[model samples]
Target: WTEHADKKGRVFYWNPASRHSSWQHPLTPSHKALVAAYRRIMQEEDRLAAIQSELEAFQQQVEEEVKGWRQSHAPDGTPYFYKIGTQNTRWDNPRDELMAHMDLRMKMLQELSQMPSLLEEVAPPADVTGLDRTQDSAGLSEAAALTDGPGSPVAP
Candidate 1:
């Protein structure tokens, strides 16, 4: 293989006795430019592949976390749905509803957990005194009321 440079200072390789005649022939400025562009495209592809691998790793980590959470919080032994319209069993335990509530809480907590990192990326908010940062438990009470309300299977 012989290396050659075009008028534009672009480089190419000349391979003799190759099935591809283009490689054996002298490269023009356009051909050199195409080669450079191809090299750049290959470099970009490599960089993207690295980024894709990182993303896959991160995805696997998240999946594992979710699996572990499900195993710990939502065991298979626990029934997720309750049967209705049965005299032998008038009502089922509110475990499924409670699990849904727990799942929602987990998702909210995950979102809230990212707030510190997001805040770090931007300017800090102005400090204000006497402002309440704590969440009210009224919503929790409301949810409980709903669970024990009429039409609820758990309701006596």
Candidate 2:
């Protein structure tokens, strides 16, 4: 990194590797780590913002899907909704179903968020000298142990 002053005499730090400038001083290795961390933070923030935007758009689409719907009751006091000028009728609120779907999607999103950590845990280490500890003599599974099948299974 190199330091310079702006026209107003305000000091800043520049990184030749990243070609980025910041007002904060990057004087040490820790500061460089901070810069990398800050970049990661910014990327995560942007990712969250995009997810939020998509969620908002999804909600808006749901609202539009149920626009002009009027709530009413059935003869047995069961609630329902009917469109303003159409033959469409629903026995349940559209939002209720959509919200339930969104809940499932959010759960999937949470699981997806942890996938990288799971992958990291299962990945091979850079140093392979100790990998033999997990290997068998043939480095393979027996026919009876191949998914507990007597023979290899064909691909679907």
Task: State which candidate has the highest lDDT.
Answer: 2
Instruction: Supply the global lDDT for candidate 2.
Output: 0.56
lDDT tens string, model 2, 103-154?
5544544454445452233456554332223445887743322222333444
Q: Which residue ranges in model 2 land beyond 4 Å of their true spot?
A: 1-46, 75-77, 110-156
Can you give the lDDT of residue 22 in candidate 2?
88
Cα lDDT of model 1 by residue, 87-148, tens digit? 22212333432344344434433453345442233456743332324445664322322233
Candidate 1 Cα outliers beyond 4 Å, as residue runs: 1-90, 116-156
The candidate scoring highest on TM-score is 2
Q: Model 1 misses residue 145 by how many Å?
A: 58
Cα-based lDDT for every prediction: 0.40, 0.56
Model 1: weakest 10-residue lDDT segment is 82-91
